[model samples]
Target: MPPSPRNLDELASALLANGPVKTLPAAPKRIRVRLGGRYVADTTRAVYVWEHAYYPGYYLPLDAFAEGVLSYPGSGGGNGNGDRESGYALATLSAGGVSTDRVIVFTRRGESGSEREDGNVLAGLVRVEFAAVEAWFEEDARIDVHPKDPFKRVDVVFSARPVRVSISGTEVARSEACFHLYETGLPVRFYLPVTAVRADLLRDSAAVTACPYKGEASYYDVVVGGVDGLGEIRLRDVVWYYKNPKIECAAIAGCLCFYNEKVDIELDGKMLERPKALFS
Candidate 1:
């Protein structure tokens, strides 16, 4: 039997895309979990499981956790079937001065409201909620937001393409040197120099966001003055910069990049058409 195509319109492109592969016990990586400056879980044998199409989750063997660190506060009801058939039970992961509640501990429980079923692959494995932990590490480096996709790649290229930016018919920036950031499944971003932008129009914003591959980024709101009898416009967090980007994108540090969807961008002498994306 033939497999159903995921996307009918882009059949050729979809055919070239990466399909799910079965890696027994999943892909290996040294994953460590920390809470309140204390290491609660550390394992060299950890597998990556994709709960969503965007990012993968880490699942470690039950023994990887330190003794007495994971405590089930009781299901409050389950008919006292012991911990084996608890299914997904609430756990209090506490160590040192740190603790978190509502942490799910996946056990040998079945999907239905029943006893532990045999042949369940997740029987002996422990599923830790990534967000519940204070920090995660791959070996020694600290990871942020989420785990890095092993299949994804980010490339930074130095381009001499002359780029100009405008907001509401008001020309804001023009630069001949722009670093092009190309990430998997994302629109190409043109990062411009600070001198190329109009300083008077920029307002420092308190927004900050982190990326597993690119470190933390600070934002700026571009406020354009009234034009052609139109009121002043404020584009919130329309521009962002990385002061200390990760090594892979170190070259683009301190460079500003505007949200192409919120502003008009011109490559060379031609205006670029706004691309439809998640942020758009």
Candidate 2:
């Protein structure tokens, strides 16, 4: 039989993992949303909607939007011809200083069937497309991907277990003061301190990726022993670290976490089973 597809097969799939969605009250804060070069929505009462298989998004009340910025271009008030099943009306958003012609906007008329019971706050609200906006800020810090989900949690705990990492029989790192990051729906990730890793064996890689749950991650290539008679082996972007994690996941800041599928992780003499995940 053909081998099954490995986790982390594609970049898009790795980033867009499946998960449940929920809507909840968000703490009142000054939310300034900008698209192109114009301020689109600025409000202090932003609602958070945690959608399944996607990141948490912000929804602003209709009054929060700037005047003459939102309009329905097509018939039936842009409701897809009175398709109430969707419970949302598609509208075009345009304003002065906006670069794009018309950005897609979803106006919630009522709670969709799929929406959670607590999502009533989303009704009569407007949700802007993240890509359509140049930047979004709660107060001062810019948010990437989407707002952090309040329901999700991330915990970083110190572990004294003997953790070892190897690639093709070459020892890459070994440590006892390793930190383990546990998050919802994802596998437990073991992060080794820089002192515990063989810094000489790792070379800075050019690749960079971002996570909505965590933050921007930098990668490194592992260069060491060869496999199957090959001269020296080089694993591309096998190690990753979040130099500045989001506020919610600040526990893993500047910590290194290896891709379990790319390296052998052994804890206290037992090899760990590589977890199958979106970015395995």
Candidate 3:
């Protein structure tokens, strides 16, 4: 995704088994990972390694590793995998009784384990799986999902265009001063103010999700179809809002957004096709 950027779903397609791979210069952001309440690496010297995922993982320098190195850079050390002299600086990381079980190694591109890669740019670099760590941080803010892709962008713009949403022919929400959140690789979200939504129909949902670009989000379950022949139905977690969003997306705070795929939506009186993506 260096020359031409593509979304994660494209890489997940079975037809595209072997695809184009690219790398960029080391990013300037100070990325840090925490394991068992201890900081793993807190440095700006990190490279974005985009492999199977659309968003890249941070590959920090060898020095970024604290005293948590169990085995590395030596004679046929155990890489949590049963192999010897793989040419990769395989390591086991442990802190506060938490450890990586399998496939936790600082790998080089061209080696016994990763011979398919013909280069050594990824050699001597420590790439940690996010799930193996307790928390990941960009500066001080906790990042969820995965590392934010530099190529991807999120923008919130105030718009006056009329927006409307209907569920099973029942008008749910209509707004004139809604905000449009355009996020790369996702469908555009129409974030309407709370006053524009039907608060009586909305019930608090237990679902919560986090984003690296946007902050933690709380959801709402909208109840509909309580009149005529239709039975009363509760659509679960179909709407969400970020009470406190990341600084870059502060404009979307306290705004309600419906799942464009779950409900019928119209913008400026024109019907909009339901978007197809992971959210859909």
Off by over 4 Å in 3: 1-21, 72-84, 87-90, 96-98, 108-117, 139-142, 227-230
Better of 1 and 2 by lDDT: 1
- Summarize candidate 1's per-residue lDDT along 20-135 as a digit string, tens digits: 23213443567899987888888887767554467666767666778777776554432122254434455567788778753544455544332224534344455566677788
Backbone clashes in model 2, listed as residue pairs: none
Residue pairs in clash, model 3: none
Ten contiguous residues with the weakest lDDT in model 1: 14-23
RMSD of each: 8.4, 7.5, 6.0
Record all residue pairs in model 1 with backbone atoms less than 3 Å apart, i.e. clashing: none
Best by TM-score: 1
lDDT of every model, 2 decimals: 0.73, 0.67, 0.72
TM-score of 2: 0.71
- Give the C-alpha miss distance for residue 36 in model 1, angstroms: 3.4
Ranking of candidates on lDDT, top first: 1, 3, 2
TM-score: which is higher, 1 or 3? Answer: 1
Candidate 1: how large is its RMSD?
Answer: 8.4
The CA lDDT at 180 in model 1 is: 97
